[model samples]
Target: MKFQLDEPQGGNTIHRHDTRSVWVNGTEHRNSLLVPWQGTVEDWRLTRFEDLTEAHFERIRALKPELVIFGSGSRIRFARPQLYRALIEARIGMETMDIGAACRTYNVLASEGRAVLAALLIED
Candidate 1:
């Protein structure tokens, strides 16, 4: 679905998303990516939810977002606590959802000027 909103001047915002891809700032990205509310988008290099590791969570931790929206591809799959123990220890909040929901939530939080990160996994 396409999200109708004026793009914020600096921060990243999801403009559209379907099952296969997500559009950030009008650019379509088909692979996994990390979208920070106020930073450059980067490739997440995670193809599946199972690929998630402590190191991956650590990377998100380094961004220091107050909340994280984890898009577990096409469905809602919870990750083992051990995979993201660092986030729990750091007191950062994380919510897991399907990719589409994650996109929508990310847009809302970002528009509200919240420090949020959307770690979305898009299947090939």
Candidate 2:
């Protein structure tokens, strides 16, 4: 499925997404990546939900987002709270969903000027 959103004036907004890839600001990303509401897009090393770890969540914590939208590949799978204890302890909110939903939600939140991050996991 593909998603479309009215482009935000600045910052990153997820423009489109399908099962195989997510397009951010008109650029397609097939690998796991970090899409901050207002920052550089970078490749995330995690490839699957199982690859998630405290270290990974710590990275998200370092980004200092008010909330995080975790795109767990093609389905909705909640991560163990311990895996993201850092974010929890920091009081950073997080929501888990399928990749497609995450993309849509990210776009909405970003367009509304929320400090959100989309940590998307793409199956290899």
Candidate 3:
């Protein structure tokens, strides 16, 4: 995928490439990253931890976000031991929360200049 960066003066700045990936400001996202009190994306990459693996990790690892917010479905559950260990070993910060909560949290952290990676599953 080709990634393009767009810097907006205000609100959430979205980066678009084709249609597979998007990033709000510097945050890494599969779909889109919503800025707090800003807005949301029509189609954002929303996923559960169970849907991720080392391969996914490797792909996202390239972004080098300080914290990766994992929306574990619509609930909060501890991430798999394997993933947790691997993420920690890679010095990647991980946050587990509900999908909606994750999205909100992601934007806040990203807007604050935190290296944030978000995986949120949202309903249209």
Which pairs of residues have clashing backbones in candidate 3? 31-45, 46-120
Better of 1 and 3 by lDDT: 1
lDDT of 1 by residue, 59-84 (tens): 99999999999999889999999998
C-alpha RMSD by candidate, in order: 3.5, 4.0, 9.6
* Residue 22 in candidate 3, Cα distance off native in Å: 12
User: What lDDT score belongs to each candidate, Candidate 1 first?
Assistant: 0.90, 0.90, 0.54
> Per-residue lDDT of 19-48 in model 2, one digit per residue for the tens?
778889889998999999998998888877
Q: What is the TM-score of each predicted model, taking all chains together? A: 0.91, 0.92, 0.56
**lDDT tens digits by residue: candidate 3, 15-90:** 4222333455556555433233233433333344455566555554555666788665556776675755656777
What is the Cα-based TM-score of model 3?
A: 0.56
By lDDT, highest first, what's the ranking?
A: 1, 2, 3
Off by over 4 Å in 1: 1-5
Kindly report which residue pairs in candidate 1 clash with one another.
none
